[model samples]
Target: MDTTKIEKNFKKLTSSNKIFESVLMIGNASGDFNFTREYKRDIDTPMLMASTTKLLTTTCIYALVQEGKLNLKDELSNYLSKEEISGLHVFKGKEYTFELTIEHLLSQTSGLPDFYLTGTKPVFSKVKDRDFSYSFEEELEWIKHMKARFIPGTKRKAYYSDVNFDLLGKIIEAANASTLQEAYEKYIFSPLNLKHTYLANTESDFIPHTYYKDQRLYRPLFIRSCYASGGGVTTARELMIFIKAFWKGELFDKTFFSKQAQSNPLQMSFYPIHYMGGYMKITASYPFGKKYTLVGHSGSTGAFAFYCLEKDLFIVGDVSQIASPSTGVRLAMRTVLAAE
Candidate 1:
């Protein structure tokens, strides 16, 4: 690997692009590949990881299953005896309690309302100390009150609901008798020796800060209180490390990983998340054949990333811009296949 060319390419990437701030590293998870690594300033400075947090939730669920503390098929109502889980008439409706389950949350099949439904924006914008928060119990409570548009588990649409991961967070907590943050920290972060990666619920001051107005919307490092399971905060190094480790069979049973890799036909896949789980699997397209089957995930909003597993050990430069990193992923493929 030519350091000069790599550095030149990276410099060109960040210099020309509007990278708000990012940190990234790419290499082999199991000692097979190590390419250019750039973990520069403000990179991985503990920004919000957004939907990539779902992968984290998935890991926690699998761990509980592996430990026999939770079952995918078990009804979630069995654990919570509160008013929300009861089949009684609570929501001015019938016994509307048959639509909830653990797998429903895991597969996004709970028929739960999408997060975008509640738009209090005009009022929310006027408030100063309005921290963006969504409670798990309240969401489930809403589900209890709300009627399903369709039966659960019939369709596999990629409905973006924070409630899905929030429920999984609850399930993880119930299975371990600990907070989702504790379970994630103890099982995943700590084991990986990942300093920059903190569970959403874990409070930390060093996670960096971002601003919206004078109010400072949410502390970039301290936001897990509400959106922990779905949109966790993390850095480039941490994200890359976790992705590589999980993909390389360093963390769990190969069989389970394979199971996770199974594609969801009902949902259209996107860059870096071609298959699902920790990544997307791409086989080929009219543009790039075979090499296009790159596996990875893109989120942690305003940030784009890719990691090549089968073709070349690679990680791309991070950009905290509005555009998704798919464009860059396509360009980088040309470099990875240069017959090094």
Candidate 2:
């Protein structure tokens, strides 16, 4: 563990822009190189995990699978009524709504257009003010108004849809007869004793502000509607704990974990960030001819939690810049290289 080198890399990343506050935590199974450092934000402040929330959502889903409560291959209609998810994934000239499966949603293969970015005009464009937020129910209504990207299960095709996980959130709730937040606490946070990690159910929660361009803003209250998809909040220390347990099979068996990562990946809207099932993977070669593969997930608000399988290392933190989503990955790479 090279604290000097890791801090050096963190400093470089924060210097890039005013919006780029950060907290970085890196550790290995041996507890070497384990430290938490923050820039502009306190080390204990809880920040939005953004899309990294999916990692938690998927973990809960898989736990249910392990307990025989759910099956990945189960159809979406099995749990959701047609009215609840109605018109959400209509294709060229046909409706494949019920045909969509849990596996499709988990792997982003459902062909559901991303309600945020995939529309002919993105949903964000509808936001007259950047301060606006939306509820998950409202997001589903908006999704019902959009068209599907393709027929479900088309070979070599996947679209990153927040809708998929939103529906999965609903499924988790339906399956458990409880709220998504409670499900998370029972299945993930509680067992792991993660006192700080939780779904941000409202904008008034004590979450740190994230940077979007030049604006400093707290995530919208409505964004909490997407809690199952990207509405998690956690400190750097807890984020590392979750990611390490996630990849090391602490939440479930290793065979199920492997199944979660075995799907074909789709490039996220960021560099070096790829998605398979509910997790993200980063594959890169450091300058010294060393290649690293790290798996977990990152948030668009520059939050990241990933573990390097080859090195048994965990990197968790945020660059806190919406525009600098790649900063976390860059820091992870540099940190790994420096540790060597």
How many pairs of residues collide in model 2?
Answer: 0
Candidate 2 lDDT for residue 82: 73
State each model's CA lDDT, in order. Answer: 0.54, 0.77
* RMSD of candidates 1 onward, in order: 5.2, 2.4
Per-residue lDDT of model 2, residues 200-302, tens digit only: 8854566657876777766465456557888788888787778777877889876875554354556356555556777766787856787888778776677
Q: Pick the candidate with the highest lDDT.
A: 2
lDDT of 1 by residue, 16-132 (tens): 534434444556545565554453454446666655666677777777777788877887676666465564222234343444667766665544544333333321232224545
Give me the displacement of residue 119 in model 2, in angstroms. Answer: 2.3
TM-score of each model, paired residue for residue: 0.72, 0.91
TM-score of candidate 2 versus the correct structure, residues matched by position: 0.91
Report the C-alpha displacement of residue 271, candidate 2, in angstroms: 4.5
lDDT of the structure predicted as candidate 1: 0.54
